[model samples]
Target chain A: MDTRERLISSTRELLWERGYTGTSPKAIQERADVGQGSMYHHFRGKSDLALAAISRSAREMRDSADAVFTDTGTVVDRITAYLRRDRDALKGCPVGRLTQDPDVMADPELRRPVEETFAWLTDRLAGLLADGRTNGELDPRLDPEATATALVAVLQGGYVLARAAGSADVHARAVHGALGLLTGDARRSPSGQENR
Target chain B: MDTRERLISSTRELLWERGYTGTSPKAIQERADVGQGSMYHHFRGKSDLALAAISRSAREMRDSADAVFTDTGTVVDRITAYLRRDRDALKGCPVGRLTQDPDVMADPELRRPVEETFAWLTDRLAGLLADGRTNGELDPRLDPEATATALVAVLQGGYVLARAAGSADVHARAVHGALGLLTGDARRSPSGQENR
Candidate 1:
């Protein structure tokens, strides 16, 4: 990979693993195996590099969601596929994890991508739910905006539960719980593999 | 407060603000206005003191939930009270936040209280849900444990969204969303003050 690509990927990994405050420029350099001159040549500094990384992470998040969202299926089916997608549950969401970092939150430039990711996610999901309601697939009275927010929260919060317990089972259970509530049909959304 | 009490409280705040890896022994001593001798005399080290603070935080979490969970109301009503309770929404959950701290998650001792807090929370909510089912207050087919897990995740994930956006409104929205779903009544949960 080019030095810029290497630096951005390293920053992304560090941001996910250590957070903004915990991750250092020197660490980024070491991880990317690029010298300080190379890093500076590619970007202004740590914050600049982080922004690039975060924006990339946010784009990736939306892309993955859209992958399931735009697929051929009923709205509920698509939403379920997105929720149950294979993930490193214990490692947590790359974009969602940054919310806990004080440094990232203090800087709006740093926080923008994180905010945009969720905004876009909920907006996209809400649109899908609205389509379902219009087509008489979901309850007419369902509040798509609020329900969409809740669905996104379940995925983010499921990671929190999974990490706290040091087990992915709790995360899976949380997802199924949400699916049960949304679908109003537990039999169809049976709680699958505990550790998957 | 006593020296020991001061140390514990200070550690609790630091853990919440800075996390395990970010908080240092010197920082803790300075925050508590105690010297190294006093700090070491009161506890073994950062880990032991953190355990005490985390356990205290866990107890407080349960106490606050019980305050709502045990209130005289229908199961859904009690759950709603807990979800809608006023909070430092942007600051995130004290116990749940630790789940993101790598140092805390890596150590069994540090992680125990966090795990127990969530386990107790989900278990307690599950019991309340089961009661709702038995008493004909909720759907008989509802899976109490999974539903309980999802409810807790909403709260945890709500903080995530709130922090990311730098607004408590999203957290409140997520709460009402879940409440609406669980109760299947959105009108009763008319979206409240956006800033509240």
Candidate 2:
């Protein structure tokens, strides 16, 4: 990667791993294998680089989610595909995790990507649920906005439960648990790996 | 307050406001009005003091939650009360916020209180829902464990959504959204602030 790409990529990883307050310019320079001169040449400072990184992370998150969202399948199947998609349960959601960083939330410039990403996520999920409600598969009266809010919260909150336990099973439990509720069917969503 | 009490209180406040890694020993000493020697005399170091602070926070969290859980009300009413209880929505959940601190999650000692607290919470909530199922107030076939998981996620995830948007409304939305699903009555839970 070039100096700019290296810096942005490194900043994205650092932000995911350590958050904005914990990540430092020195660490970024070290991780990116670039020096102060090159970093400054490409960006104004730490916050500037972070905006690029945060925006990149948000887009990456949404794009990955959108793939499953827009893919051909029953609405339940697509939503399930999105929730059950492989993720680093222990590491948590890169974009969703940013909400915990005081530095990020304290600055609107830094917070925009995070905010927009969720706005898009809720809207996208709401749209999908609305489609599901229109079909006979789900209860016709299911509130799309409320249900979508619950689904998004399940994923983010699942990360919290997983991290707190230092185990990934709780994360899966939360996901399948949500799938069960949304499906309005009590059958356990196949763990896909019950042995684990 | 005594030096020990002051130190614990200050650490809890800092943990709630800034998370584990963002808080420093010097900051703790300054906030607690205790010197480094006094700090060490009472505790080993940052990690030790943090354990005390985390445990205290967990106990306090449980005490407050237990009041609602054990209160006289229908199961849905109690759970709704727990979710809608006045909270520092933007500041986020004190115990739930710890899950986001990588430093807290990395150390088993530091992570235990958070894990135990959530474990207790999920179990506590499941019990309440199971009671509802028995009383025929809620759907008899509702999966208590899975439903409980979703409810807890809504609260933790609600905080994430609200913080990302820099507004408490989304948090309320997530809460009432879950309540509607849990109640299975499908009426919008009043935000109580329709005026806003």
Judged by lDDT, which candidate is best?
A: 1
Candidate 2 TM-score on chain B: 0.96
Single-chain TM-score of chain A, each candidate: 0.96, 0.96
Candidate 2 Cα errors over 4 Å, as ranges: A193-196, B193-196
Error of 2 at B134 (Å): 2.2
Per-residue lDDT of model 2, residues B1-196, tens digit only: 9999999999999999899989999999999999999999999999999999999999999999999998998888898889888887888889999988888888988999999999999999989988988999877667888788778888899889989988888888887667766776545655583222
Error of 1 at A101 (Å): 0.3
Model 1 quality (TM-score): 0.97
lDDT of 2 by residue, A126-171 (tens): 9998898788767776788878887899889988988887887787
Residues B1-111, candidate 1: write the lDDT tens digits.
999999999999998987888899999999999999999999999999999999999999999898899889899889888988889999999899998888899999889
> Where does the lowest 10-residue lDDT sum fall in candidate 1 chain B?
B186-195
Q: Under CAPRI classification, how is model 1 graded?
A: medium
- Quote the chain B TM-score of every prediction: 0.96, 0.96
| Model 1 stretches astray by more than 4 angstroms | A187-193, B191-193
